[model samples]
Target: MHLNYTVGYIIPIVLDALKDTELSGDWWDIQPGVVRLCGDTVEERTKNMDKTTRRWREAQRFEILSGWRDEIYTVYAPKGSPFFYMERSAHPLFGVLAYGSHMTVYVPATPTTPLRIWVPRRAAGKATYPGMLDNTVAGGMGNGAGPWECIIKEAGEEASLEESLVRAKAKPVGFVSYFYVRHKEAGGEAGLLQPEIEYCYDMAVEAPDSGGPTLKPCDGEVAVHILMDIDEVVANLKNGKFKPNCSAVLLDFFIRHGIITAENEPDYLEIYTRLHRRLEFPTR
Candidate 1:
């Protein structure tokens, strides 16, 4: 199925779920291997899409897939055109492309000290990837927010880093793309597709003595923040201690920093190529 020019892959279970909703009624044209919103204008499409999704949410449909985030994410076409908005939880159901931003916060090595990163552990109570290590700051881009703004917002929410600090220090360092399959850790059925693009950023922070901020758990999503040197982080990555996608972002960081190279890793070329997979859906 295609949303305008953006391809959307629907699984069999998702198709069966949609058949039980208003989405299969007048709002959408649901045919085998093809689906389209049935509306003449963007406003009409958005309205009908919202109504259909809201009904499913209220009815608690797709509960087995994932819990509703209540956050809305925009589906886009080529040239950054907004096709419509859908609830965040429903995104994986339609297998639409998802956008997010991740920032790695670290203090560069000094003559006496090695480079160290601030890593956060997800709270044990969280629904997804509980107690796993995550990037210093990461979040999904929602409600039409741009990547830069999303990063800054997530920095404060996830790590209690002030916006001024992030705005002053963060540098956009390209992105990492991946095709993810959801499983128990992701709180969804096995094999649910979630192709994602995360706008990556890196921040070289000053030591706290220089008036730089120290990470603290502001939102309950984070259990705690720890400052660990490069060696420890590499060990965790090898042990699969980080969330899979977050680990991918860290691998991107390592490659960018010249840590993972031909001399060090046998599969350096393969790993580098897979980090930026050419996605099937439209990304604007």
Candidate 2:
């Protein structure tokens, strides 16, 4: 659908299903290569869309919207433009761009130890990517929260990190952008496109004896937090143990830290380009 620009694409399955349903309201217009919402203002469009999506969620007809997270994500038209808000679960159905923040918390190498990162395993019963290894702190930017705000909230909730420590130590790095096609492994209808951007951060903590913050699972969303050596993290990434985007974030961290350099990695340039991929769609 073209808002200010092409905000999202209604895939074939979703399009056919939508066509079968009664599009009674003046909510949307579907054309050959364009789908437009009738509402002129952002508030108007959001209201109309939210009402429609609520109906879809309640009806339980659309498989993509079946497991409603109840979290609302702000959609951007091209980039830095607020378009409207949608339920997080329905984002893939429309091929919308998703944004989140991931923070890597690590202890620097000392004379007795190598640099190590705190990695969390997702709770097995979670709706998506359960039991997968993830960045130390990660959460979607929902309800209009910015990256730093999101990280601070997530750091405490997911990793049991102190807000004061996070606020004082978290360093905003760059981001990792990618175009991903969801597979069955992602626990939903396969082949849905997700052009995503992850705002990355790094937090370097002192060893436990030095009075640094320790990480533990505060919420049930994370099964456990494990501090692992850098080499172990590399091995896990090689084996696809981390969630796809989490792996990407860790790789971005490696590149930023000069651990994966042109001299050591053959695809250095390609990796750099892929990590900072320019999205065709608008972003916030």
Q: Pick by lDDT: which candidate is best?
A: 2
For 54-130, candidate 1 gives per-residue lDDT tens digits of: 77666676664347787888877677787777788778877789999999999888898888899999999988889
Misplaced by over 4 Å in model 1 are 1-4, 21-23, 64-66, 209-211
- Model 2 stretches with alpha carbons more than 4 Å out: 1-4, 23-26
- Quote each prediction's TM-score: 0.91, 0.93
Query: Model 1 RMSD to the real structure?
Result: 2.3
Which lDDT tens digits does candidate 2 get at residues 1-284?
33457877767877765654453255767778776766777798888778777776676757667678878898875547788888888888888889999999999988889889999999999878889899999998888899999999999999989899899999999899998888776877888889899999999998667887768898899999888999999999998889998988999999998889999999999998998998888778
C-alpha lDDT (0 to 100) for residue 195 of candidate 2: 89
